[model samples]
Target: MPSLATTETLIASSGRKSFRVVFEGFLHLMLLACAVVSIITTVGIVLVLLIESLQFFRDVSVWEFLTGTKWSPLLKPQHFGILPLFCGTFLVAAGSALVAIPIGLGTAIFLSEYASPIVRDIVKPLLEVLAGIPSVVFGYLAVVFVSPIIKSLFASADLFNAANACIVVGFMILPTIVSLSEDVLRSVPRSLREAAYALGATKLDVTIGVVVPAAMSGIMASFLLAIARAVGETMAVTLAAGATPRLTLNPLESIQTMTAYIVQVSQGDTPAGTLEYRTIFAVGLTLFIFTLLLNVIAQWILSRVREKYE
Candidate 1:
């Protein structure tokens, strides 16, 4: 029904629009490709760890690996006791959580409920800077600075020991917990706070009762993440927590975490393809599983809490 010129113009415009749509779709496909690549890479690493761990278990009985207390893979009689490492990891993680939970939660409360815009601007950057410090630097600080101070204080009090590493690790994870928890607290609906105020709730009461409960899921997830970081930390524990794998419950006694033991074996130059070399992968698998379980639990909690709030 249209003239040739009008029909040609309409065809050209439609072609251009179609081309634009295809180009946008291509960009989205590229983003999806990147996400797939990341997932594949993570899966590949887990597979490698699993395969090597299976080989180690083949040589060492599952019970021996799980129940053995001594972790001397290089010694004449190889022992692959995982309990000592578990003990060390739990001790450090527990200590870190004890130290971080209060301070981190307090900081979040201040940032979310108390701090003014100007104060927040200055404080948020400072908190981020603390997180930006390298783990190696934190390790050095624990070894050179914190350990000495802890030794002095504890020696004076007659309480000095390897527990100092736990304290230092706690401090190292403080920033992470604070930053994450604060973001979650800030995300709570303003209307909730307003409702509390209308009900004659004090600022403190509002923050503690309504806001904190609402953000509890995020706060808990942050705590779990902090524990994961503490468990996987290698250099800090290696330098500060001394490599003595004892089955003692005393935090003051020297202990070797799974990560620290891995670093020790790797740095000590265990020959490739030997049992000692394979032990690293085995230890790594344990650490990975521990952190993975924590992450899954954290995610589940967060999802349920978020759904309730939504």
Candidate 2:
């Protein structure tokens, strides 16, 4: 038989273990509830967009809004065409992607494969500092600095054209691309690199042939995230890209994006119930849907990549 003291110690240990289990269960429940809040909030926002957009559609045909060539909702014989907004938005987003992808990818590769720990520690912080800067600041810079430079380069370039806005938006998105991509690259198993090196592969070969392919999903995700950021950016695009909704292919000309339009109208005398004001919800819903599609693609890519590794 065990001694009384030993029996008592065992009972005390059991009691403590039970208490820990109970405490841990409570923590898990709390975390689960916290996670649910974000999902609920997202669903709630979508519902609001849908409800308000439906209210808009009651007055204007969905087909007309989607297919209209002009977007002058407030003018006489108003045309509620979304094409002009979509075109401008796409052009700017594409430009931002062009700027961010190559440069951000290169930065990620350098940080992941080539940089010393000290360099990474210094450079990483500096890159993240860009993200902390407000969108309005970037907008101001776009107008005062970027637009002037572009104008100097091409004498025909208009102030507050797509090019300046694109450049600024791209710069705004660079940090997201670099940070996420670097994390993805760094997540590649060290053993894979070791094995490649053991098989007589050079560092370049391993990085290019092995690490990059392995991290493709994450890199693509980063790119999509950057695209989404540029798509939704308001103040910068507003200040830089003039509010001229048009179907122009030239970067030298001015344009307005969906976000810029919504911002423009929301700041004015738009009372809540008017059809003019309801256009905001419609545009917002479109934007939400576009972003949702991008996120869906990202998730699909992530799943496929995860499957490859698994």
Candidate 3:
């Protein structure tokens, strides 16, 4: 009993609605495909690392790799101990943490608690620009500039030393910590600051006692993540810290990190299927494990902090 015009209108509306549903379904499929691709890529990387590392372990004992102090895989009478690499890696990471944590946290505090809006807007971008600079540039800077400074300060320091790498890697990870910590500090609720003020607390007391504690979870997470980055950093460490795989803790001495060794072996001279070639995967797996553990710890801290704050 509907008129023709009304029938046409209804059909047209239904068609449009159907088309919209189809479009939305297509979009959802596309998003799902992207997510699946990411998961597949990650799984593929893990599988490759595991398969290659298993082959590597077959030739070299895991105990030796874990507990051994020497690591001269490519040289004559090759050694496969990974402890020196481990020590060197952690040395840079720890030193970098010392440089980054205090400066980064202080910068975050100044930005979040003290800087004017205009100053923050100007300074934050400049700070983040450090993150965008290539690792190779930092390496060059370390070699050309930082290493010389260290040599001047300490006559015993080598041109390629752990301290040089540490300083450069610290600068490399600084932006991440500062940016993340600042965001976390800013996310603390305004009500907390107001409450502190009402109780006769100074701005410093409120910032230190209330806002920082409230955001400590996020700040700690950022620290872990930045340290992970420093641990995994390759080029700068490679250039600044030479290929010496010594287990000593002296910052003035040359050293080699796991990532640096991987880079050394991956330069196409080592034949495929050889023990040396396979070492890269083994080192890669170790680096992956280190970063994964850091991420897991960061996540646990973040969740616990969030629960407390919320």
Candidate 4:
């Protein structure tokens, strides 16, 4: 018994509701698909690395891989010790951290707390430009530019040394740490700084004591990510660091990182199913595991800091 106009209104309302439901469901399905895509891709990579590494372990024992002091898998009498690669990786990573953390953190603090709008605008774009440059370019720069300077400064340093690799890798990771850390520091509530200032604290004290402490979780997270990046760097280190795998703490000496060695082996004409080819997978798995632990630790620290703040 409803009027025609009233019936038409009811139909329109029902149609709109139905359309909205369908549209919302479609959006949700798209989001779910995006999420699953990453998980599936990660699973696929892990499976391939795991399976190939298993084949490698059939020929070489895990203990030998973990504790071996030498890593000449391609040599006739193959020595599969991974410790030398680990040492070189750690040495370069440590040196890069030395350079990146301090300089990057200082840059972040200046941008977030001290820089004027004009200065921030100028410096930020410059930093981004530096970051956008290709890693291969950095490697070339390290070889042609940084290596000579390092050799001059440290007379004993080799042209292709761990020191040069560390210096270039440090530059490579600086923007990541600085950009993320600046965001974290800037996101610290202004009220915290004001309160410290109200208590007669200096600008330096307010920044270092209040703002930096509040943003510790995010800053620490950035450092960890930069370290992981340094660890995974292949091209820069491969070109800069010498192809020699040695267990030495001296930055002046030539050495090869795990990633560099992997690159070296892959560049060869080793056939598939050969020991040389399988070595790359084993090295990849080892590097993956090492980087995974660093990420887990970073997450744990970040979570703890977040809990405290909350």
Best by lDDT: 3
Compare the candidates by TM-score and give the number of the best one: 3
lDDT of 4 by residue, 29-104 (tens): 9999999999999999999999999999998999999998988987878899999999999999999999999999
How would you encode candidate 3's per-residue C-alpha lDDT over 89-176 as one tens digit per residue? 9999999999999999999999999999999999999998999999999999999999999999999988899999999999999999
TM-score of each: 0.89, 0.89, 0.97, 0.94
Error of 1 at 12 (Å): 4.7
lDDT of each: 0.84, 0.92, 0.94, 0.92
Clashing pairs in 3: none
Q: Give per-residue lDDT, candidate 2, residue 181.
A: 94
- What is the Cα-based lDDT of residue 135 in candidate 4? 91
Model 4 segments more than 4 A misplaced? 1-3, 307-310
User: Could you tell which candidate, 2 or 3, scores higher by TM-score?
Assistant: 3
What's the CA error at residue 117 for candidate 1, in Å?
1.2
After superposing candidate 1, which stretches have Cα over 4 Å from the reference?
1-12, 156-161, 303-307
Query: Which clashing pairs does model 4 show?
Result: 68-81
**TM-score of structure candidate 2:** 0.89
- Relative to the unseen true structure, what is the C-alpha lDDT of residue 163 in candidate 1, on a scale of 0 to 100? 73
